[model samples]
Target: MSYVLITGASSGLGKVFAQEYAALGANLILVARSEEKLLTLSAELRDKYNIDVRTLMQDLSLQESAEKVFAFCNREKLTVETLVNNAGFGLSGAFDSMPLEHLEKMIILHNLTLMKLTYLFLPDMKRRNRGSVLNVSSITAFQGIPYNAVYAATKAFILTFSESIREELRHYGIKVCSLCPGLTETAIFDKAGIDPYQTLMPIGPPEPVVRAAINGLEKNKNIIIPGLINKILIHGGRLLPRSLMLKLGIVLGRNKKAFLQNSC
Candidate 1:
């Protein structure tokens, strides 16, 4: 049977996406690093929604992890009708001081893994002539971010890639969407050692953001940016000079750095 497969399905926006899809009566294949959490989420969804829920515990950051996931799904005959590439993390610090390992993992997980999963699932989706792909990017994808350089670039890749494919798949009745959420209430900031409450921007909840994304996808919207403030910032930032935008990003990055230092 066809199912929606979501990466990073253990917590944060990923977990929320799982719930949202389940609520819509969609069967799910939840992939994440934590087996315990994935199993728990699967049980909850299965019990509440009475839909088939499969769990795959794998770290997308590792080499060949995406292939393994594809293999697992194929073995189980779980045809993926919707793919949500939502697994990613940010590292906040000066590019020179940040750990190269973390950057590499971000590159693999945020960019490579998403690409592979999409590629693996695309042919089947084409054959079915019906599918949806939701790529969870960030508002930072609209411009360069100094402290979170690699992370922003990876998300930028997602935004552009999703747009490109959205056009190509339109003729095949496949929906491809890029969800560029601004600051949301998620553990990503905590993992990055940056506090969202200390930031200047308004942080939103994951529910509305994910809701807007799924709704947009249903409407066949290619780019889904949630929240009024974020929509303004993103669209307004495009009108500003590139140099000014970079400068503004630098200032925000510095504030984030100061907060991280204080927390440490």
Candidate 2:
């Protein structure tokens, strides 16, 4: 049977994607680093939605991850018609303070693996003349986020990459979308060691991001900024002068100094 493949499916927006797909009677392949959480979510989705649910617990930061996941899918005889490359994290300190390893892994997870999966899966979909790939980018992609430098740059890459490929894939009936969401209520803040009570970051819930993505996918929208506020922010960044935008971004968005000083 055909299925939707989603990375980082154990929690937050990934979990929401699973549920949304399950409700539509699509089988799911959930990926994440936490095996126990993956299994739990799989069981729940299967029982609740009566749709097939599969789980892969893996750290996508590793170089071989995409190949390994493709192998697993092949072994299981799974066919992916929809892919949501949603597994990602953020670093909210000064660029110099961020650990080199953490930043590197983040790039691998956020950018490289997504590209690998799209490349691997696109060929099959092209041959069949139907498919969709959703790359989860961010609104921050419009401007440089001082404290979250690497993460923002990676997302900019995702948006550009997705848009370029979407153009090429259209004639083949393969739709590509870059889902650029702003902050969402996820365990991400805690994971990044950033206090949720912080003054600058405002977040909406993950459900809207998930819903908007699926809606855009159905409508064949190329780039989706889920919330109105995010749309405004993205537009605002584009409308303003570059130097002014950069100054605002640095003052309100980055923590390079703190992170650089404390980086391990």
- Residue 151 lDDT in candidate 1: 79
Best by lDDT: 1
lDDT of each: 0.89, 0.87
lDDT of 1 at 18: 98
- Lowest summed lDDT across 10 adjacent residues in model 2 is found at 255-264
Cα lDDT tens digits, model 2, 202-233, are: 67898888999999999989899988867887
Give the per-residue lDDT of model 1 (tens digit) for 207-259: 99989988998998978999998889889999999877876675345575564
In lDDT terms, how accurate is model 2? 0.87
Give the number of the best model, judged by TM-score.
Answer: 1
> Candidate 1: RMSD over Cα atoms?
2.9
**What RMSD does model 2 have?**
3.5
